[model samples]
Target chain A: MMSKIVRTMASFLILFVLIYGLYIIMHGHSTPGGGFQGGAVVASGVALLIVAFGSHSIHRSLLERRLSILISIGLLIFIGLAFGGMAKTFFYNFLVGSPIFGHIPPSGPNPGEMSSGGVIPIMDIGVGLNVAGGLSAILLVMALATTVMEVEE
Target chain B: MRKIAIAVSLSIFIGFLIATAFLIHPFGYPPSEMDDYIIENTQSETGANNAVTAVIFDYRGFDTLGEATILFTAVTGVVMLFRAKKKREK
Candidate 1:
């Protein structure tokens, strides 16, 4: 119906927003934003999407359950990466020329580029995912509770 | 009812803004120049080139741990507030 058209348009707009948000988050590591700022921007975009389109319209697409799982998974990955590094050389730049399991050297720039160098990029990705997942979990749980509240009345 | 709820929440949010304003000094503490040392050493020892990470996790570890505790508490509060909704629905 007409409502579906409106929702579909809104959905497309939200998708645009989310992509832009990711771009911002990715560049954020090197620029003004770090994990917290970039994460929050991406999270807010998700929240705005929820507001514009009903959960049923987008919930499955967002993978509510998987996102919750990913939240913990990201945390574990980050912590494991951290502690694992600690055990080796007391938190050595294990990600750098880390050789991807001691085989391949790190990404280019001859290992001299600070921003382009090792482990930092990996850490940024992990933090970005963690923020996105964590924020989504908060929204999911809140939404679940709110839906229940409506049912109770 | 929705309007009242919105108003109340807004007030609470505004109140927090006000409360925090007075908690810290406007003219902040002296520049410790402490971060400079951490930044230099972190590159060699910690291997973390990111200055913020070196300062937050390695140099000021105790504060970072405290922040983690704060995040835990905030999440716990949200869960508790919403917990009753599930039972009420059933």
Candidate 2:
């Protein structure tokens, strides 16, 4: 069993890393790291939990079915945004007129936003969710496959 | 028993080593010119900041559509393989 200090450190580290990674994803359009990188970091946090405890422990929180659903939902969000927006015009910027301070309006003609960048944030969020779900799915499935115990009858 | 354990572990380790050493590219390298072109062009067309997604979903949607079909084909192959294995085991 881990000592109190170690447990506290683990808890603190988990929160810090996950939130930091989320910050990276949120500011991805304006900053260095994007959705994939941030998403991988988020997965790393989940992996850290698996490494510290066992697989069944993590499963208590993020189940396999939930992870699969999240992945599908993320992909659907992106697809829905695409076709739904495309319905308006061929290559039309769906977020053209949205309001923002640092960036120009998203709807007009020019692309790239401080905020005017269009649906990139929504896309980033979708990709982030997709990746988080995917990584968790792989981890959860592997955990389930290996969670057997040998019994002597 | 130790010998059996060692041999099994060794073989699995060796398999992983071979796969990692050769299956993945020899070394990491910078993106090629084609990649650079897609990066600039897709971001331009899709108004999507992520050039990769733009290319996959918009710029070359047909290509991705074909790739998805190929993935479905592979899944079919895997199911067939599993059925054959079950039949043999039974």
TM-score of each: 0.62, 0.59
Lowest-lDDT window of 10 residues in candidate 2 chain A?
A144-153
Residues A1-153 of candidate 2 have per-residue lDDT tens digits of: 245676567777999989988887776654466556777788888877776666666778877668667766766666666665676753344664545422332333344444324665665676677777667666655554455321111
Candidate 1 lDDT (Cα, whole model)?
Answer: 0.57
Residue A142, model 1: lDDT of 81
Report per-candidate DockQ: 0.15, 0.12
Kindly list the per-residue Cα lDDT of model 1 for residues A21-133, writing each as its tens digit.
67755554234454555666777777766666755455668855576565555555555555655756533446544545222222322244344323444545556666676
Q: Report, for every candidate in turn, its global Cα lDDT versus the true structure.
A: 0.57, 0.61
Docking class of 2: incorrect
- Interface RMSD score of each model: 5.9, 5.8
